[model samples]
Structure formats: C-alpha cells, structure tokens
Target: MRTWRLVRVVTLLLLAVSYCEFFHYYMVLLLCTWPSVSSVQGFQSHPLRAMFIGDTHILGSNAHWFDKLRREWMMTRSFQASMLIHSPDVVFVLGDLMDYGTESSSTEFEYHVQRFKRMFSTPFTTRTEIIVGNHDIGFHHMINDKRYERFKEAFSAPSVRLISVKDVIFVMVNSMALHGDGCSFCKEAEDALKNIKWQLKCSKGKLDQEKVAEICEKLDIMNYSRPILLQHFPLYRTSDSNCSTPDAAPLEEIDIPFRIKTDCLSKESTDLLFELLNPRLVVSAHTHHGCYRLHDNGIPEYTVASYNWRNKHNPTFFLAELTDQDFIINRCSLPDEHTVFTLYAIFAILLVIVIIIPPKKQKPNLGKSFTPSNKDH
Candidate 1:
C-alpha cells in the first residue's frame, strides 16, 4: 500500500512539473526576444523601392508569438522605419499569410487580418499588394473550402491585382488555383490562368506562348521598362528537388528536406510562370529554406526564409535597393541574440522541472515475525 502511494505521488509531481515547463517555453518564445532596426551597409535610393515578405502563417492560438517577433523586428511599423527607413514605394507579401483558408473560423481569420493591419499601418508612399498561397486557399486537393472567398472578403479582391508605382508595374497573381485538383477547370479561374499563361509561354504550347505575349503586352501598356515579379512559389528548381547542375549538392546536404508538401508548386506550372513573366527579378517564399540563384536566363529569383517555430535559425527578409547601375538584393536575418536567450530560458525551465519532481521513495516492509498468525498464537 505504501509503495503504491509513493508511485502515485511521484507521477502527479512529474505531470505538474511538465505542465509548468511547457507554459514557460511558450511565454518566453512569445515575449522575451524582440528585434531592433538595423541598416544595410550600402543601401541606395531608387525611383521606387519595395520590400517583400511571405509565409507568415499566423493563427489566433499561436499568433501572439509571431506578433512578439514582428514587434521586435520593427515590422509592425512602416517599411520606411526599417532597412527601407527611407520609405519604400511599395510593400509586397508573396503569400501564405494564414495557415488554412475557409476552415479557419471568423475569429482566427480576423486575427490574421488584424495582424497585417497593425504591421503595415504606417502611411506608405507606395501601394501594398498580396498574392494568395496554397494554405490561403485551404485544401488545394479540393475546392470546397471557399476560404479563398473569405480571404477575398477580408483582403478585398481575388485573381490578379496590378499596381503602378513610380511608373513601375507590379503584378500579383493567385498561383494556388492553377494546378490544384480542387480548382481544376474552374472557368473564371481558368480564364485568369489562361491570361497569365499566355503572357509567359514562349514555345510551341499555345497556352505557354499566349502567356508570354500577354505579359509583354501588359508591360507595353504600362510603358514600364523594368518590372518586378512576385509570387508564392518559385519558377526555378525548389530546394528539395535535384539541381540543374550535376555538381550541385542535394537539398538534404544543405539541411533542407527532400519534400515539403506545402511549399511545392508543380514544376510544369512554375516553368510556365517564369517563362512568361520574364521580370527583371522574381521574389518568392514557401520552401522555408532561403535560396538565391540567377538562372541561366539572367533572371534572379530569391526565396525568403520563414519566421515560424520550424525555421528557428532562418527568420529573414529581403532588402532591395535600386541604383542607377544595378539593383542590389540583401538578405538579412532577424536578431539572433533574442533567439539564443529564448532557447536558454527554455532549457532552464526544463531543468527546474527535473529538479522539482523528486524520485519515488521506497517504502519499508513489515517484518515476517510480525505476521498475523504468530501474533494470534
């Protein structure tokens, strides 16, 4: 009986200790480390400047942590407040702002909407544009969620949106609906896809050729000599896939996984998208692993890392400074000091739990001489 009692006490104590440690880890992660503004060494002013961010994936249950991190990074203010402290002409979010679409409740959806409203609240000299990602569409395998519709309602539009800033045109397209079985053959969506497809395609495929022409025509209409393309998925090879160069190392060699389902866009669609847009530069993020490559075609595509729990060391953003001679792209990491401190704080909490939950004590047994039969005799 005594032994059983001791074991029960030990179990209860351990459970209590674990609970405390878990709560402490989350608290420190959300509130302890904050980011500060830092300057890029050789930033230059452009006729127009733009800042790009993607794959935020904020939710009410876990948004506080993101909010804390964003606040630290000085992202809650205008773009001009940070690296673009001079004030960028525009801000673009590539996609995946929320984790899941319509399945996300009103409260959860509103939480993400509010976070954006707060983060980019500063008056911008340029426009703010957003593209839809796979998560924003909800269940890309099927079109039943209608989450994209909700997102449109919250964000104010669907399909493609064009912004002309400082005589430069920025085209933001919804890539989620293109290849997903859920949206296959959606007439309106198909038409939009066809329009984008025609502008990008350059070869024998009618759809591809049409897309390329359309994009060129759009540039003509804008009369812009240089444009920038922004999308959630990259048109080039993904981090997990085989590289174009035989000498290149595989993704795993670089600490990236072979497949990240949420980040992948079909190779066929990406090739088509890249071929048509042919922008001066392309920026995207979904792979979580940051990648910078100048394709054989001379187009530069950059994938920004994420600011989530999974990507602890790679929370990052891009700074593009336009100069007369050339445009410079700088990939910057958020403060590492706070992240390191947070990690230590978590370790300390776990250690405390171990110390507080004492091991079970062995109970003393009654002697055989004290048996009931002997006592009776």
Candidate 2:
C-alpha cells in the first residue's frame, strides 16, 4: 500500500514537471484569440488569417545539446499550440531562420533546415513562406554565391518574392540584398522589385493596358490590394530608444545605436523600397524584439519579437488578419524563458522534497497483528 501511494505521488509530481516544461504551451490554445479590427469586425469577408514568426535562429553545431533541445522544444510547442488554435491560412517566417546558416557547410546547413522544419511544422492546408536573412546567407559585402544558393535551395526563398493570399499581396524581400551597392545580387533584387511594382500597378488599374501586357503577362491577380512588405530587416531607424511598444528592446539596450545596412536597411535602400513597393504595411524580424512604428509616410510597421528563447526572455509572434483594404496585427507572446525556468526550479525542489521526505509509516495494527487467530485446537 505504501509503495503504491508513493508511486502515485511520484507520478503526479512527474506530470507537473512535464507541464512546466512542455505542456505549458497548451494553455495558449485557450488563451490566444484572433484579434479583430473593430471597424471590420462586422464585415462579411473571410479575412486571411496569417501568423508571422520572427527569427527562430535554430542553433548550429556549436550550441550545447541542452540549449538546442530546450530552445527548439519551446519553439515547437508554442508554434504548434498556436497553430492548433488559430488555423491560419498562411504562415510567414520573417527570416534569420538559422543561427549559423552562413557559416555551416552544406550538410550542416541541411541539418539546420530539417530541424527548423520539425520545429515549425504546420498542417498541409496551411502554406509556409520564408524570406532570406543576413544570417541565412550573409551580409551583402560578404555574401557568396555558394551560401546564397544553398539557402535559396533549402527554403525556396528568393531575394524578392510576391505572394498573394486572399487578395493581399505580400512582398517578401531579402533585406540582405538591399545594400544599395548595385552588386549583382542587389541588381537582381531591384529587378524583382520593379516586376512586383508593375504587378501592383496593374492590379490597381494604374498602368496602361499595353504596359500591363508587356510586363504583367504572368501576374494573374484578380483583385487589388496594397502590398504588405515582409523582410528580415527593419526599415531605417536610429534605435529603439524611443519605441514605446510592449516588448521593445530592454531599457538598457534600447539606446544602443543600430548600424546602418547592418542592423537596419540603409536610408537609400529604405527610400527605394518605399517608393517602389508603396506598401500599406511592413513586417520585419531581424531586431529580435517587438517595435510598432509608423513611417514618415504613415505606413505602420511591426517588428516581431524573436520566436526563439535564446534571443529574448519573452518571445512573441504576430497574428495578422489581412483583407484587401484592411489589416490588423496583434502581438501574441509565447511562454517566457524566465518563467519556464522558474517553474522548472520550483518543480525540481518539490520533486526533491517528495523523494526525500519519507511517506508516513502507518502504525502497525497491534490488535490484528498480535491477536492470533484461534485455530481449532
């Protein structure tokens, strides 16, 4: 009886420990709700539900096994939990998908990609799209053909891509290629941007029919929508010091200056992108913290926080409901690393206590034990 009681208690404790580490994400299934724009809430359109994840930064060979396992598990659980609840039509990974992608060999890079797929796997009905990040390839000045090609092959990511979902056009750009140096990659990116611009113009009925026939023969867009710019780097910004949004960089780091073209796109590149794309909304992920800012042109940009625990204590993602003329972005947070660790610590202490403290020894039933059965004598 004592053994069984002890076993039951231990099992319950183990279950609690599991919940602290893994099952915690399951709560978000109930907690997370699809936020709606009040004005458009009553609209009868089937809004395109899209989930955006920031830098996953799947660690490479150099990371410790425990760190890799912990971080990856957190990402997997959070993503899968939210996916189950939201059932988004499309998912966008806003770059920096790997930590050492630029440094890894072909085999190592492949492994990272495989691991990322496992971590962020989604249902077949939901489409996944990715954009290239500086880490996925390299900085413009240091990018090489081998690295760039391997990344593109791995993720099917291009320097610039246009995807239309539910009449909402998402312009995915490789921010790394926006160095404005007119290198071969830069030139290619610019050309793709021009093509995308023409497609948008055609959609808006702004281009002459002849112009559309000349350049937009392949674009089969049936409805018009402003482009939503998706990239790996944020637009030009000095720093997040003045950013008042929740989950902005920590107070101490907010004032640190961002390096032009490295931390953010160069001013020239930013101007060129805005002029060409004329995006109604922009979403980027390289900063690894949340920032909601409106450009001088009055377009809103949401910088998603990193989805990986290694980047921030409180990781988060963006849930966007997009329509042809409206977009609503909600910042959804994941389980905090510090909170999870604290729970683990607490559970470990309780588990130790359960093991160390002896189960009470039941007082022997003296009457029954000592009273001998009167056999027939």
Instruction: For candidate 2, write residues 173-225 as lDDT tens digits.
Output: 99988888789998999999998787788778877778778867887655777
Pick out the ten consecutive residues of candidate 2 with the lowest summed lDDT.
Answer: 36-45
Q: Who wins the lDDT comparison? A: 2
| Model 2 lDDT, residue 291, Cα | 95
Measured with C-alpha atoms, the lDDT of residue 333 in candidate 1 is 53
Q: How does each model score on lDDT?
A: 0.56, 0.86
User: How big is the positional error of residue 317 in model 2, measured in Å on the Cα after superposition?
Assistant: 0.4
Q: Give the per-residue lDDT digits (tens) of candidate 1, residues 1-377.
A: 55665666566556554544343333432332222232243443434566667776654454477555644333332122442343455667777776655456777777768866665554655566777777777535544536667777777757565555654555566665556344543445556645544433322233455655665556324333344667777663546343332212334555454442345556666665555555677777776556777867788877776644334443566656543224566565543436545655665665566556665677788656643565544
Candidate 1 weakest ten by summed lDDT: 29-38
